[model samples]
Target chain A: MTAVASGGRVGDGSVAMLRQMIRIRRFEERCVELYSRGDIRGFLHLAIGEEACAVGVTEALDTDDAVVATYREHGHALARGLSMGAVMAELEGKVEGCSRGRGGSMHLFDAPTRFYGGNAIVAGGLPLAVGLALADRMNGRERVTACFFGDGAVAEGEFHECLNLASLWHLPVLFCCENNLYAMGTALRLTESETDLSLKAASYRIPSWEVDGMDVRAVREAAARAVEAIRSGGGPHFLEMRTYRFRAHSMYDPDRYRQKDEIESWKQHDPIPTLSEALLAEGVLTAADLVSMEEAVDAEVDDAVSFAESGTIEPVEDLERFVTTPAPADADGGRRS
Target chain B: MTTVTFRDALREALREALRSDDRVFLMGEDVGRYGGCYAVSLGLLEEFGPERIRDTPLSESAFVGAGIGAALGGMRPIVEIMTVNFSLLALDQIVNNAASLLYMSGGQFNVPLVIRMTTGAGRQLGAQHSHSLEGWYAHIPGLRILTPATHADARGMLRPALADPDPVLIFEHGSLYNVRGELDDHAGPVDLDHAAVRRPGRDVTLIAYGGTLRVALEAADRLSGAGVEAEVVDLRTLRPLDTATLLDSVARTHRAVVVDEGWRSGSISAEISARITEEAFYDLDAPVGRVCSAEVPMPYARHLEEAALPRAEDVIAAVGRLGGCGGSDG
Candidate 1:
């Protein structure tokens, strides 16, 4: 239940982390091109700059632990080990997608990985996370439900209600607040009177922490600590990851609200190069290693693109499928004998 | 067979579900210690314990969404909202999450949750506490809407609703809680996919469900005395409507009249009337008639509130307008 200590020396773990972040970044960059070329459409929200928060928090979770993420969840899905091809196929709205193409970029779902959804509504997933944890607790399972949302969710009433319920019922839930400065076009200061998200969480009597979201190591440490506390029956824990988005809120967003300098400043601390260069400086990762990693990521993205391109569109006739599970023939008007 | 109130029958159903399945639990505002706002869960807390019979805070969205999550997490949660009007606060959760999850997730996740709420305008609870919005909920695709119009349905609907592998919403008419009827001791889960013929007649079919079933039956009684035989059809399940039974009854009777507690425009009665016209248009002896609640928020005064709601007089008047009966509104 203790937090993992970081020795500040680059190792295989750091290399893997860097590769993961690179995979997310490169995959989304390819999506942007596909989206412009009309291969993929709909509201695509990229987590280009906030990759560290997704990678670190997901790294600390066990496979059995559930994850409820937001619309900006490409990084979260990739980090949670969903196959890149499935996510890509989903973005392309193909039958082979994670949600069978029913959910696009904002609604990715993979049950085997325990990823609840790519919920589009802000703060919508908090209550679900609380309930998932409640089910686990009631069943005597020590599993944690990690919920990821933006700072915008902090203003919603469900956020407060869920926090209070999770703490009051002693449910094991890890609340990850990815504060990427702005909720779409509106800045946090304009929307939230109290900008300290962790402080707001603490008001509900849950343990809270604020971490450097740009640093993968910091996010990992804080997440591990929080998950440990939750698994050890410390109730719910909140982490306010102070991060920024390097891209517009969505593909449709003009992003005219924020200054160009702000976006550039956040890009300077992009989690991919930050960790890679740290490893390079520490002599643990060579220039050759960096090139190979980039090549591997490129190949993976290319393969995913090909898979999505070849993915089939679902037939229009089956549109009504899954609206409700099919009932047994005899079960319709028959009594329970 | 034993005589029991609708409230007792519902409680027995809840008890049976909890006793049979470990995954079954009841949760909502004042569902535990407060014993439910209408006293339907009066003695449930001591019998089932606090964990299963949970009393949530006044957070409709949170608890309802939590119920959806719990259902996804492999538990059968029966969520109770005190009234229909209050459910608006959780509309996003119900529409966006609960109803859409199974389809949106490509059938990967199905919410097997049951949400129970008091609906219908009666008892002069005023506008906020009264409103028959089950029709609005029935408009949703992924949900199975059930209205327990009879004691057997009140006792029998929960088991099947829970057994369903999708979300189900049960609208319990507040006025029927104290209504007494004979329930078979062996009463068990009934089918949730059909309408029941409460009374058989040949002249016309009087369609109703939940609270309005009583109104329809009362109108039928008056019609019988006037020598105008009126059949009473209780639509148990509003969604996935028993179109077969509806058209069959209309086919035989050659006339139909829908009585709905919900307002006329875009109401379930409108949907039923349209379906009748669409499929059984040739079988009609006359244009289908409808008696619905007046288009106004319920008033506090007993007389105004009663006047705003559909009564036996409304149904009789509707039948008279259809030229199916010579009986005038009393």
Candidate 2:
């Protein structure tokens, strides 16, 4: 409900936005540390710098709308209101985590939050979102399926096919492209000669938009309008959230793709602090309040680490479970998102 | 109660599934006004309408991917490929997306989709159109492969598959679509995990599926003439292979012969033979053998086509090789 061009305002909503963003920032920063300490295994893809896109887009949706995120989806999961304890416990591979620790960080899932998955395959969630939208349409529901994929996913044939079908059928699908400059190591420019992703969707006759992903408010506003369109049977819409990932694509990258100065240049427009500064200038909350809020988030993340530490490991016997739904269809371990 | 060909059984299954569930729909090339390429979906478009009986573009990957999406979205989608050869174009969606979604998502998503494709050669359709890739799909986890050899299975497997929470591939032999038989009862809900004994015997176990089942049964009759009572086992499902039935019969018979239309080298028959050896080698008096199609692209000539597909003669010869286990007694 608050209107700020990118991170230029400190309205009543600023503190909430800052808190969510900081919570994700602290959670993933600790994740990177824990991953190094061997507390986590497998590929840990942290959404360190792209917190604005998750928080902003999620802020625009309701509780019932569906969300399908990518591997680098910790921020999205956190912003969607999946308990920090559950997300942290998932990363810790505990049975009590969102997907019962079956989904590692790259595969976080919480069905209750309507976050469909933390799909590891690039562009895999697009078709799934289209399917969810199809279900919604058939059920005569007004829910929109916001599918989050990286700019790299645009190159995948699934993306093209899904967008075409969604547009042709007038399905309520919001194709959210998180253009974080690079696709793992291959930069966006390398994949498409025309690096503008929204244009690609437009090429498919789908409605498209571009937003400053560095600014949470801009992302939120753009997402709100697009989602509103989709919810009202406006068919499908595409948004290119031009953001950046400060960390390596995953834990494996050596930061060989972009220069530090470029990172520093983008860091100037970091949504968390920039919005806090504007909020301070607007007299909504003082610098003390921002610090205290961040401190609270830090403490909350610390509690998350404690919860993850105390979380119980799934028994080895259940390892063969969930691969198939087994004899009973409903008996499949239903997600607790 | 109804005498139906394999094609009508499939059509009946489609009609029943589409009528029974609001979420179940049929989609593929020529599945609409044309009454389907093989007529397995005949009268379905007229009954279910164009929306539910979707006609897709020539793009196999796109439509198949869309079907997977629809399945994930909570719809029971039965996508037909017209023939097994065309499925290669949609392999990315089937093998990659539909098959891997469950495991990759850490069991968060289950793709409840059914893909039906006409398979095998004998109609002089040539090398490009004739293939039996059930073995390749069997190699992939997360998918259930069903090769129905009877009217009951063709009618029965669809309901359970529509209810199952994962992808299931049904490979129907194009050559057997016209094979009709007297039906006593409709199979209500069949298990996708085991095999069925179509014609029981005692001497040698004749194991086969899809296009090869008829040959196995014919061979069993031929063996009966020679006093060799060959038991026939139809492997309705291939993935969680009903090795239990295949080996159990082999253990009793003291010999086994697998008949598969797929090529022998690394075929499903090869795998079944290795499994029989591993599980029931001690129970056998002779080594297990296979009556698989000759390793070729299935030549276009009618005689060549006949040579490429495993036949009753091949099964009889394989059964003849089990001389130690009563074949010599005959």
Candidate 3:
């Protein structure tokens, strides 16, 4: 299905995708500055050139649908409508954080939004997605669960195991594989014997496809179709989103594995400018409109940083809380340690 | 009192759970048509239908992780992984996600999931199939490890486990499935937070659980015959150990002997010995004795397997050593 718009709603939707991408771009650019200043600690994995995949795919999901994301999930979290302040505070490890200062950048979780986690383990969230969809199916609910993982995860055993379970059980799950060429330092070609990820899913009898991850409209259209099929009892669907990550895998990496020329070349196809230029050509956005969007996103990100800075540290005494839900009154008495 | 086999008690518990709550479901390989590897889930599929007593492929990690997810989605899921040996394949999901999610998510999520797996070495299932690793699970922080040692507990622990907000692992000793006993008709949710005295006495405490509970009781019987009056303590809950009950028993008896099927090094028996030393050290009349399985991958031969495990004689020997009989390890 083509994303080309003919009416007011379609035109507005296209502009919204552009705005979401701009928001992610500005928010993460600010994260880099905050990380260097030590305001944000721990491993920070950015989706600098992967704005379209997160925005487009998340936009396709209904509010009732659940999302299971990987550690490089700031883009996915923001696009899923998690408050910018909470996401920023989580990164800053404050009491106002999404995980209450417990899970720094790698584990931003919000129960209200149905964002399952900000999982750190490779391929960890796929099985969780299958289970979430299983819950929906068992309860006779028609909600879909979107599971995001990287190309590197294909080698992990859970990737294959979860795929088979989802299909065998016919659960409503959309497996979105962000094929960003490399897993940390190892290139996909060097790792996967069959680099075609869609073929892997198809082997399990799930309808799978390849999507242009750099194009927001293309991704949105593909995700919409897959999610529609899932909701209509089509079981699980897989999308091999061919995308690229412009930043180093994490802040610690010098990223000497790939050539600087290769990075610069991928930057030429960066999703933000590509979508913005398309909008400008379509008269959906003017130079003045673009400037205002950038200014608005920058100010919003600035406010998030300030919110994170002013947030409180969790009291040290409450450290052991939540280890086990404090036992109920009728629970086995006097044995709790 | 009602007579029931351990296997039937487990099935009854599962049936009650499925009937009482729409959210409770059982999922695992061969759990439906094949009636479970141990036949504990027999007839559940037909009663609850395929949606509730769901069968899964041989993928352990996926099904177990799905149980965690289903629990998070407000459904109480009971996932059975054929045996403890098979559970190793899904260790990542169990250790990384199910056990850590609540704490890592800062309490935003709680996995009200029950994972039942057959544990202990017996019946010549050999090295791959037979092993007791429940103690390894007991080391985890966020999980509640339970070993249902009697017919009442076999029928009672599931409801409490399902009601528990955190992840609870029920390790049913494979050998006890055929053991028949009297279960009270009024039996309901059993308290899983404390150890219970199976047979009370004042001489010495015989500590064990699951398969080893029989051995401890038998040793207690032999000790009573010898006019020793040994008390038997069945540890139902492994994690969040009831040191209060344990110390009370030790304080009264003035001696303790821990019997476990798991090997000795860093085993649950070792933890008990350490606890008694820390809490009731002065109350102990001798060094705490341990009757753990000989440190060997369980052999297939019947006699060797029997020898490899902690038998009633081993518990008797440990007790005798506490009474100054000739022994080294104990």
What is the TM-score of each predicted model, taking all chains together?
0.97, 0.93, 0.96
RMSD to the hidden true structure, all candidates: 3.1, 3.4, 2.7
Q: Please give, for residues B1-330, the per-residue lDDT of candidate 2 as tens digits.
A: 878798888888888899899999888899998888998888887787888988876767767876777776678888889889999988877886787667655566778999999988888999888888889889887788989888888888899988878888999988889998766564566777778888888888888888888898898888888788988999888887877888778877888888888888888888888998888889898888888778888898888888777888888887777685464444
The better candidate by lDDT, 1 or 3, is 1
- The DockQ of each candidate is 0.60, 0.45, 0.75
Model 2 chain B scores worst on lDDT over the 10 consecutive residues at B321-330
What tens digits encode model 3's per-residue C-alpha lDDT throughout B174-198? 9999999999888889998789999
Poorest 10 consecutive residues by lDDT, candidate 3 chain B: B321-330
Pitting candidate 2 against candidate 3, the one with the higher lDDT is 3
lDDT of 1 by residue, B1-330 (tens): 999999999999999999999999999999999999999998999999999999999999999999998888899999999999999999989999999887888878989999999998889999999999999999998988999999999999999999998889999999999999999999999998889999999989999999999999999998888888899999999997999999999999999999999999999999999999999999998999999999998898999998999989888878887884534431
Candidate 2 residue lDDT tens string, A157-260: 77887888888788898888989888898887777888878888998899999999888878888998998888877899999999888778878778887888
Q: What DockQ does model 2 achieve?
A: 0.45
lDDT of 1: 0.91
Best by lDDT: 1
Error of 1 at A29 (Å): 0.3
